[model samples]
Target: MKINRLLNNNVVVVKEGEEEIIVMGSGIAFGKRKNDIISPDKIEKVFVMKDKVEYEKFTQIIDQLPEEHIALAEEIITYAEKVLKTKLHEHVHVALTDHVSFAIERKKQGFQLKNKLLNEIRVLYSAEYEIGLWALQFINDKLEVQLPEDEAGHIALHLHTAKLNTYTMDETVSTTVLVNELIQKIESKLGVKVEEDSISYQRLMTHLNFALRRVSEGKPFDDVDHDMNELVKEKHKSAYNTAVELGHYLLESYEYVLPPSELVYLTLHIQRIQRNNGEEV
Candidate 1:
């Protein structure tokens, strides 16, 4: 291998058999200046590019990344690929690699670091970790090697977030809990029997879904009247207000806040259902 461009004393750009590779570690290019004989033992990783354009792109990427970060990223990619038996997409690999690198740096600086995206990461990539660990054990019995546990934990968190984002709670169970509470407060004001399973209730659920989607997309509520139903306009307005209020309440009481649009949609749904069967709202 010959040096092409040196990123740092610890990191170096090199050519190996007509392939460009980013070598990392303490002694990657040790003792030898540029164009000097490189030691294979000191080299940690060799990132082979597909072509000259990719080589240039990879070089630029390495320049932006810190040395320690590059090392951790390489470690993560190698471990994931070798042990997990799963091929992560480039996008996911890059994201995970960068996150791991930054995390390690933060920890070394005495910063109490927590992977905020840990849950999401776990949900998305736990299978990879499971396979990786199994492979590691198979490679060397009593090797005592371990996969990145913290990183694995984060993957699990993402799964939880995904579930909450996609699934709607049953009206008779979780949804009813919130709906019943709201109905009790508005019963005297509207003066009607609230039915839990009415068609209006379903409509309200649909409305809530719309509002939630808008909120999740970061759209403003003022833009909400685009193609709404005329008959449900007043009901939706009322529901939106209540949903916002309930969202705030949940945030304050349980430190859990749904996005504004989500709350708007959910509240509208509950209100519409409660006012079903000729009930007043």
Candidate 2:
């Protein structure tokens, strides 16, 4: 491929047909100017970025970024993909690299941004959270920087966003925060703690996740069974009431009203939690 430009000695932009691809390797573009042909053997990684803004940002930021930081992000992403068994969005290379670089810089300056959603992320996105924890230790071993566990939560969020591809960072954060809030509400209303690792809790989290997605996508729950809804409401008064409280919270926070069918399923889950806790449901 022909060089379009050089971002750094180890990073270069090359053109293949009409597309611009970022190529990275040690000394890949050393002593080379624009329009130089890159040898196939020198390339270590090739990033074919489709997001225009992210591509521009990646190219613009590389000059300021340490080569090791970029390499570290790639290593973490590779590990995450391997464990998660899914390919993340290419934007992660840019986003995670920028975030980790800034975080390391801030650490040297004696400041670390606190992740408020750390607990929620640990509970809601356990797999990604585990990867994030591994990344923190990997960063420590490679860079000798002891980034706090909160950084793990931030990293997990980035990985989660990339996995979903559809949810932006803001949406992912919002969803996690909302799920945490809903769980707290459930605990408060039912007077029982939902074990984060329990099967019932996982089911509740799964239902809440899809419910939020449905609401955000404007897909109504059209399979409302009035008889079942009324029976559950009557049989499981406390759980049904807690579900109604969660519904109100969703309505107020998200402006999306939960339908009766959703309430019924949600009530069942809550009742199961209560039953698991040895409470009268």
Candidate 3:
């Protein structure tokens, strides 16, 4: 396709059918005027817009920032999508690109922001954290700069935001806060810490992440059978009691009551994990 609009020496915007696509490659747009057909051999990546709002913001960045950072963001997002096995939010193109751009600039000027939540992010979002580390390596290779691991945590948070399918920063923070609060209440009720590194604990983390999001959005698991819930309450009395306590806490604190299905699963998870930790359940 012909170059409809050149973003930079290495990037261009092309019209394919009714949609606009951003094309990237080293020197792909160099010395090529508008409407010049891009050589197929020179095309390295083509990013089709999925969210017009996000695409608008991304194109704004493309029109303003240096091409290298835009390219870096593309590489990182592509690699992350492969490892993550899901399509990230389209805003990642602009957000991550802006982050990498400023990160490089700050690194060159001897400035690095310490990520206080680095440890929590490492344990809670290991997948995204690993992807973040990969991003650091990619940046180092392409930009010839060694970014600190704390930057990985920051990048991980960004990836986490996209993974949650939430566009706002507020949603990301809210989810994290709720997850931490739920775990704290569980540990308090059990009078023991859940093993952060254990596989069972990982399972709990995943469950709570989605659970908290649902509660925050006023959504409840509406189809839980009362009979099955009664069975669990009878069979696993101790864990069931703790789950009821947690359910009560949610109602008291968040004004959202947990459904019976959620309580049953919560009891099962708590019992399994507590038993794994050698606690009496």
Alpha-carbon shift of residue 6 in model 3 (angstroms): 2.1
How do all the candidates rank in terms of lDDT, highest first? 2, 3, 1
Measured on C-alpha atoms, candidate 2 has an lDDT of 0.87
Please, what are the lDDT tens digits per residue for candidate 3 over residues 1-281? 99998878998999988889988899999899999999999999887877889888887898888877888888888898889898887777888889989999999999989886675677778899999999999899987999999999889888878764454766776666677777788888788888777777778777877787787787756566888878888888989988888788878877877788888998999889678878776
Winning model by lDDT: 2
TM-score of 2: 0.88
Please give each candidate's TM-score: 0.39, 0.88, 0.79
TM-score of 3: 0.79
Candidate 3 clashing pairs?
A: none
Candidate 2 residue-wise lDDT, 163-270, digit = tens: 844688999888877777788888888878888778888788878877988998888775867788789999999899999988987788779789889999999999
Model 3 lDDT, full chain set: 0.83
Error of 2 at 68 (Å): 1.0
Candidate 2: where is the Cα deviation over 4 Å?
Answer: 82-87, 222-227
Candidate 1, residues 165-243, lDDT tens digits: the string is 3322232123224433544554444455554344553354335344444444556664234245333445566655555
Distance from true position, residue 261, model 2, in Å?
1.7
- Deviation (Å) of 20 in candidate 3: 2.8
Error of 1 at 201 (Å): 25
